[model samples]
Target chain A: MRKTKTALLIAASTTMPALLLSACGQTPTQGAASPSSGVVTITWYAGPITGTGVRSTLISKFEKSHPNIRVKLISAPTSTNTDRANLTAEISGGASTPDVFNGDVIWPAQFGHAHLALDLSHHLPKSFFNRFAPGLAAGASYKGQEYGAPLFMDAGFLYYRKDLLAKAHLPVPKTWSQLYQDSRILQQKKLVRYGYVWEGNSYEGLTCDWMEFMTDAGGKIFSNASLTHSVIDSAASLKALTFMRKLITSGVSPSSVTTFEEPQAMAVFDAGNSAFLRNWDYAWSNSNDPKVSKVVGKVGVAPLPTFSQSQYPGYSNIGGWDIYVNPHSQHISQDLTFIRWMTGTQAQTILATKYSEIPTNYAVQKNPAVRRVNPVLNIVSKVRLVPRPSGTPSYPKISQAIYTNINSALTGSISPTAALKKAQTQIDRAVSSNSL
Target chain B: MGTPNPLEPELTNHASRPEKKSPGIRRRLARQGWAFALPALTIIAAITIFPILYSIIVSLNHITFTSQGYHFHWVGLHNYSVIFSNPLYRYSLFFTVIYTVVTVFIELVAGLLIALVLDKLIAGRGLMLAVLLLPWSLITVISAEMWNYIYNGVYGVLNALLIGIGILHTPVVWLGRPLIAIVSMMFADIWKTTPFVAIILLAGLQMIPHELYEAAEIDGANGSARFWRITFPLLRPTIALSVLFRVLQAFGIFDLPFVLTQGGPGHATESLALLGWQVMFQDLNMGRGAAIAASTTLIVLFASLLVLRAFRAQVGEEDLG
Candidate 1:
């Protein structure tokens, strides 16, 4: 009995401190010697997808090809902002974190500024980096250093009823003026209940819509390359806002558009209620599916219309997510290889085939098979893609300010010029603040 | 918390100790008491009080985590002044107050009527109670999504029903206009929460003696008079308690508007809690966000105190607790 009690005391004393110490684990030393384990494991964090996504098949193939590196998958909230917040919390805790992760297009600048993303310029040659679309590659850059590998691509398309346009004997609209003229003519002929519909809701979708208009009219948010001045308070932005309002006031778009996000607009358009709908390319496959839509085989797609003054026609906002490496991860070399392989032509083609993903790799996008599955892919490539101000850590706040003011202007609570001034003031304050 | 206690003198006097060894003995007893209470006190402080105190401190500083990790600097009253001066905070606060007052008033009156009707029913009272409670027991997300579909602009049943009844010539956009959107969200809340108020009032009604009503009827009193003299007076404390809690719950409502309209149509329906959450989590502006949180706590405490005082004026100091 005495022996057992003594043994219990010994065990308790030894295990007690270890249990207490687990609360604050040892800080991981940076740039330490790489682990010499038999295989390297790189954790990949992606948005919450349950079944076989683009990553699963790609990872299986990659594991077969590169036997030295193993892959682990983790799911995060589907929201980009939620993923950003969760990643920040995990990394700041100084504990285990995902080695590689997906980020929305706006994340490169914010994550790079926080020093969370590893710059990949030192890892890949300029020629290899040039394999992805130039417009998409630019979104993955910060301060002329590539921090992200373009994983997939998306662009807004102006989906119209080809039967209605043909009946009206109208040509495809190349510019905003012609779009408005054709929409009015179609409405007069009663070709559709509404001439056009788009997402005008007070959300991030509005930001995408606003950027499309602002960039088409040659308006940029910042005046200098150094991002010093707030010069978005301009007449060009005013014209963009006025045109959006005209879409409603002139009866070209429905008044109910104030409540629409992407899905809302898609639902109305799929119900055979509108002549033209502005949406992302994902809607192409869905609208063409005979099981779910009334407009199957009657839809035609084109890039969003542009201002007549624009040097480039039908310039839409760039919409895609990218993958970046976490600098704090110990398996930096393995993470880089994983990212390179996933973004390469072979994996891109699989993703396009399996998931209908718009391939970011220029060659995969040009593949005849991909074009057959996604007919809108070729038309999407012709549009110029202008990414928003994403290099700053205040990008989310800046986006909120822009969308809110534009919504207020659309609601007629404030004039377009007044809204621009208010937005500019808010942006300047966010920039001048000491912390994010 | 460590400041001098206001009741210390009364406590010592109530002890009625004047012996020579009393001071030393009291000191020993106090130390023993503190020793016994230490574990529980520590746990409570760590779990409950620590977060509130830390948020107060964070509210006074500008802090954010970068790749270098948390960088902090003192901003004193700057965060408070900035949020107060911003029009959005005022707008959110105003809408929150309006929603709380309007919902609480409607719920109390409606709940009383429901309880009265339930009290006099001859049969199927249990069935009616269960059916009424179904809304209260349903998950918030599922119900909000159901309401969203019902109010959908394209294929909503509400528009369909209204048009069929000839009340609307064409389909109306329910969640699009500002005032209508706020009302629509409130309608969903009323559907889910009025049963909760009704259940509480029903319990209060059951506790009243039936003999009091019989005596009033024998004394030639009518139904309305007896209700005013007996039932209304008897139900005052329950009404007070329910109103107090409903006010607080309504002020902090989030999921309904978040999932339903997202405080849209130009932020016509966003509550103070939603704005604080957006600042703290979404924008990652920790200091200003915590200040908004602390502001909410202060407002709630002040409102609760007012509620207590108003009830006391009507029903004297009693066991309302």
Candidate 2:
């Protein structure tokens, strides 16, 4: 009798959580807008509210409709880890705050191991997920599990002077070789000081720039899609690195390229100093801004040039943000609803047109109004989107290796071959060692 | 003509208490002391001691710093060994040492020279000190940012002035080169903090008895002789205290480099403090980060002790002999 009772207790304990989980999942999806549910103040950690009313209009509308759901926006500066660190601290300490968070384009891979974000694939409908751009949807998913929906998107673009190219009697450079040649001829004619400019700093931006070059030349950071093997020391990677070096040493790009971030590169090209610049689509708007730009109405946007045009217009490194639900949130259903509502068509349209947000929705990107505001969207709507060096838990470590060694080559501290070799070794070590 | 030191708050008790006080009374007094310090002691433990002990425990284990909580692999001394072997960490440490040593040395010499000049001026010294201290009183980030604008490649006043003066035929990117970036950082640090060092040294100068200089003049000694023999010898303790403070602060500096160069132009100015932050927060390697913090603490402790010993030896050279 004692043994039977003990076995019954053990079986009950083993299946209890599973049964509870199933019941929990069903209750949320089936009774999402249960009228009986009371007010919930769910937190949404996001970028600082800008003056453009992109977030404010959506939030006010959201609040006006959903009287019972209050979204407490925890604001943080853009392009900083302060907000992520805060969420990490709170959630890791088991605090059920920030029901929703605006995660960076490259954050999902790191957020995967932490189990801090809820898996949206289980809760969000496939129809809803299918509305997003395929690249963005894939970008937001880690290891076949969707954790968030893309908030908006941006892609790399090759910004060049239309007048300079027209005057020089040349078309926009279609390949890296062509760009080098055109930039040289333009510089020699005293039309521009430098031929090409890009972010070559030893930071995360360099990693993005390196990825752009690597993908353009048909190089991958890893051999497999799972990111298990580091096959970064490729001949194509060497060619790309060497080509970048030639741009600097051959005086096509200024030596200061090693210190230039996006803003600096934009400043250089927008000042009409460089013939071509590689930056994100934001530069297009900035170039047209009369207040900041000198090259208004004279700038032309094209895809980053590749080795050859047959494969695709050169790959555009994906730049965007996503919104994820916190695993430790008390109001998971409310947060999910908020995400869907926030990333909804109307809300995304308002955000896209008003705030210069490049919405990740395929429909929104095709919207005539958004394209009018952002002219580069016309070209970027069909460009190939290459993902950053991600998918592993140690994504930051791998990128650090790429950026640091590549910067060394750019600054002449090491040869291109040596830098690529060192980067490969470091990335391999980081990948294998970081894995269990 | 004589005045009591306002700094000594316990002077009354020190003068009134008998040297042969009873043991029971002393014990009661000690208990009273503890009663007074209880609140402060608890607060200190909560703020600093607890975190330090917790960090020590964390440094021993290999933690993943995940949301579910840390998963420990239990690698003792392995983290420290990894840091020692890692070239990036070594490079960061090497630059940190150079930064601390070079900045401190320059600040000391510059501070002393300025203090000496102020001492000789006898009048308008107050005005001079106020002027010198204006930059120090400004926020460090603001100063660093100002320096960054000056070091800007294209739209900077520095490049404009250099080109206009024919000192530079073409613009040189001050922040685009590693060594130049480090030097520019040092220049900014010196500009903002040399005043602080000067104030400390000035106080030391004031503490020296003027009669010694008068007697040295009577002995036919020159101005340099008086400074070397009387001033330097007498101001050893004050110099040591100030040196200790500067060394500790410089060893753990974060804001200036962070704001100015961001340890950039290829990680040329990455300090130990910046590295510690990147490890713990950016990379989320709290285990190794703790080890780095511990190592930096050890370095600061040893460096201060070495300074103290050398100062003690200097004091002994004249007073003991």
TM-score of each: 0.84, 0.88
Task: Provide i-RMS per model in Å.
Answer: 12.4, 16.4
lDDT of 2 by residue, B143-233 (tens): 8878877877766789999999999987777877778888988898888888999899999898776766777799899978777777886
What DockQ, on C-alphas, does every prediction get? 0.15, 0.10
- For candidate 1 chain B, the 10 contiguous residues with the lowest summed lDDT are B1-10
True lDDT of residue A375, candidate 2:
71
CA lDDT, every model vs. true structure = 0.76, 0.76
What's model 1's interface RMSD, roughly to a tenth of an angstrom? 12.4
What tens digits encode model 2's per-residue C-alpha lDDT throughout A1-436?
A: 3322332232222211212121222122111233355887777777843333456678888989899887777675565454555565565555666678888878887776677678898887888888887667888888889877898888888989999999999999888899999998999999999899899877788888888889888899998877777878999999899999999889899887887888778898888889998987668767778888899999998888888868658888887788888786768888888988888887788777766667788888888867897677788766788888777668877887888788888888778889899898888867765311
B215-294, model 1: which lDDT tens digit per residue? 77999999898888888877776787777767767777777877877677667787887777667655667778778777
